[model samples]
Target: MKYNLIFGGIRNQDGYEENTEEVLRSFLSEEMEIPNVGDIQFQNVHRLGERSDGKERSIIARFTRFSDHERVIRAAASKLKNKPQFSIYQQYPREINERRKKLIPRMKEFKRQRRHAKLVYDKLLVYGEVYNPDAHREPPPTIPGQPLPNNDGDY
Candidate 1:
């Protein structure tokens, strides 16, 4: 449900559907050496998004259980490190994706400064420093007929 394996940079060719599942099974079982992954049940295995010219569409494999999903992710993390043609990602909700997007500028800033930075959920952590968007958010607008607070220290 919340977890899925996304396969990126795999080329789509004619008759791709006929061999995709088998190919993925072989890649995980043999190449990645993930034990018993072939026995894992996939709720769905399909390409995500529209096919674009000269671009390979990503493959999304939805597992029936979260544990199975995590296993695949863990296995792929180290196995695909040197393999540029393949990559894996945890499937996040749209809201989380949007929140992560907002932190891209900060992420880049950290990278430019040569500080290791990454986004975990809605917060951005750079060199163990936390940047919480909620903490810095502007206050909500005051209701109509509510008196505004004076700035001169008067009630």
Candidate 2:
């Protein structure tokens, strides 16, 4: 889903954010200050589900252009680090999600060792190069029901 990204942890208000594209646009450019955000446009924007347990619902925004999606993701990968209350994520399909589940532990270990690792789609990049799992020995899989790494230095 090159054009989609999911963001959560922003405070919610009834009838806010989803109704107007301009509000979203300014939030990107003025609030988030994403570079070249004026060039970004949304085709559709909506919250994922009804708020439950008083938790803020995540919102999925579909970009009007692929480059806009890429630009936002890249800017978010860097900018959101300083803003813990907000986070943005590139959405993945089930197949890519499965592959990322396998790569996450290794990605955590790499970050623990202070090497750069970012998950892009199904592939993990170690120090900006595609991580080849077969080229390295990885830890055994975590127990099926246990918690996975909440943040594996992913972008």
Candidate 3:
């Protein structure tokens, strides 16, 4: 899959407001020997505040191509004068595809459980015979203080 090692400089010049497009153009416009780096773009921009020179602004560039970690890094390195604090990464398309492949069975299992739980809940909500048991009238209660007959209600 195509991946980009995106990075660029923060120009510390007076009123230079780090134009990301310019830096990226400088990188992509070059004739690169590496086969990877098909196109380049600025992914993000930042203001790193004033440096010793004056206003400091950062430019983040993305080099798009299909290559491994080492190749992309090497390609980016060739374009820069100083060492870059970069993060190695893969393309989103590749990562998403891999995750989808892994999630198929788990998603099926989750759907199955949801259906089963819904069935049980529906049955409970229906108020079946077991939920409403047969109702009968209660017998009259005997008074405790009443006098008892010979073979009758003695306490």
* TM-score per model over all chains: 0.70, 0.69, 0.27
Worst 10 residues of 2 by lDDT: 146-155
Q: What are the per-residue Cα lDDT tens digits for candidate 2 across 1-155?
A: 77888877765554554454554566678657876766777888877777767777777899988888877777786777788888888888988889999999989998999999988878999878998987686655778887665555222
The C-alpha lDDT values of all candidates are 0.78, 0.77, 0.41
Name every residue pair that clashes in candidate 2.
none
Question: What tens digits encode model 3's per-residue C-alpha lDDT throughout 1-155?
Answer: 33334332433333555454554444444433444343433344334344575433343334432333355456554644344532323334655756554544544554566632111211211122212112323434667896545444354
Encode model 1's per-residue lDDT on 20-55: one tens digit a residue.
Answer: 666677778877888887688888887777766656
Q: Which number leads on TM-score?
A: 1
Candidate 1 residue pairs that clash = none
Off by over 4 Å in 1: 13-16, 111-116, 127-129, 133-155
Which structure among the candidates has the greatest lDDT? 1
- Model 3, residue 120: distance off in Å is 52
- Which segments of candidate 2 are over 4 A away from where they belong? 15-23, 35-39, 51-53, 127-155
Error of 3 at 96 (Å): 26
